[model samples]
Target: MENDCSRFVQKCHKCQIHGDLIKVPPTEPNAMMSPWPFAAWGMYFIGPIEPDASNKHCFILVTKDYFTKWVEVASYSSVTKKVVTDFVRNNIICQFGIPESIITDNGANLNSHLMKEMCAQFQITHQNSTAY
Candidate 1:
């Protein structure tokens, strides 16, 4: 039966390792509660996407304001601590004013000293999200 084959494959280490890769993207998390609009934001990065754009950008940086559900996005060839800091400075702070807090995953680029220093200088609380 189909079920029996699936079980047998699961038990076979070679089959499991050599099986067709799962192409489905994982589910995304929803925005959490924020005290006020532009007061808090969530930041994350998306890929090394296929067929680079004319500008050669293959990655995207995204941020969502928790309360307003407003999103800001930019494409980049590469993402670095300075790039993230500038994104927060020019896109978030300059456009909306200083936020009370910002949330990001524990990515090295996101949590780098540059980001930490910028947040500390601006007095913005930085929080890391844990995968559920």
Candidate 2:
């Protein structure tokens, strides 16, 4: 019975399409080591969530330092390239100093031309993760 169920699931096209996506490499992933605090950072966007009353914030930008695990979050009503770049500039670069590298998912806002120019201007390496 278990074998039959497993075979059925493996052959189901809808199950494959709607299945949970794997975000990691099939083999062991290489560990990233940060040389110092605030040296490497990871950024992510969460939302279009239910808006709040205070500022009608529906989106959140979150960043974390690789070494220290220090997190910074900002709320926005709409996410755009300009919003993302300004967040990196004012919150990350200005407050914490330039980072060695930034890791982010390949979203349009994060991968925009303006974002590329900003990183080039600051000499910060930007890395995009494989889409899950």
Candidate 3:
């Protein structure tokens, strides 16, 4: 039975390329449309910035100015509503004033009504990035 199974496996094309395959490109590579990167003067990415450490909590909330290459990083505890709000309040609103548009990851906390309300109150456009 083992000898028969081995003979059957050897006949399979998928198994034949054990290590001799080179550059087996996708057949339908151009069938999918590639996406262009989003352009925004001021953008923010609200997500986990660093690994969870024993003592320190780190979340990545980055605000970047496209023209100036200026970036602001907001560190928080996980991706919670309070932390996101605090990031906007302390890092965004207080430091660089109000941006025309605010970009954040499509996390649950970031997509909440409270976050929307905050953006509305501040007259800032809130844009969410698509998950790759």
Candidate 4:
């Protein structure tokens, strides 16, 4: 086993190796995208909470107005596509009409197909933050 592992390591190394370990270059950004100008507007952030005793998930939907710093929050249990869809449709959109966009953490529920469809139906732009 030890000999096999050494051979594997040798296979990974090439001539003219200068350092004690190998280094990899960072990945480049997507070429298809361009810089975006920040605009002052209202935005929503949605995310799930800790699981309860019954293993059910809780979701919080928060909205903040960029100019005034006004905020609002709504909670739900399931966090399913339908639940989140209905919540955004009725509570957020219906109350304030449509905002410039909605920002959300990269949760699975927020990235589902049904959520995308709902956003398309309401003509709302949805943006998700990348992992830090």
Candidate number of the best TM-score:
1
Model 4 / residue 120 / CA error / Å: 1.4
Stretches of candidate 4 exceeding 4 Å from the true structure:
1-59
Minimum summed lDDT over a 10-residue window in model 4 is located at: 32-41
- Clash pairs (backbone) in predicted model 2: none
Residues 55-110, candidate 4: write the lDDT tens digits. 46366666565545556666766556676667667766677666556666677767
Cα deviation at 108, candidate 2, in Å, is 0.1
Worst 10 residues of 3 by lDDT: 32-41
Best candidate (score: lDDT): 1
Query: Please, what are the lDDT tens digits per residue for candidate 1 over residues 1-132?
Result: 999999999999999789888986888997667888999999999998999999999999999999999999999999898999999999999999999999999899999999999999999999999975
Off by over 4 Å in 2: 1-30
**TM-score on alpha carbons, each prediction:** 0.75, 0.74, 0.56, 0.52
- If the candidates were sorted by their TM-score against the true structure, best first, what order would they fall in? 1, 2, 3, 4
lDDT of 1: 0.94
- lDDT: the better of candidates 2 and 4: 2
lDDT tens digits, residues 18-101, model 3? 846577775764531212222233434444535665556566667666545667775656667777677777876787676666
- Clashes by residue pair, model 3: 49-60
Candidate number that wins on TM-score, 1 or 3: 1
Better candidate number, 1 or 2, judged by TM-score: 1
Q: Which ten residues in a row have the lowest lDDT in candidate 2?
A: 24-33
What's the residue-level lDDT of 6 in candidate 4? 75
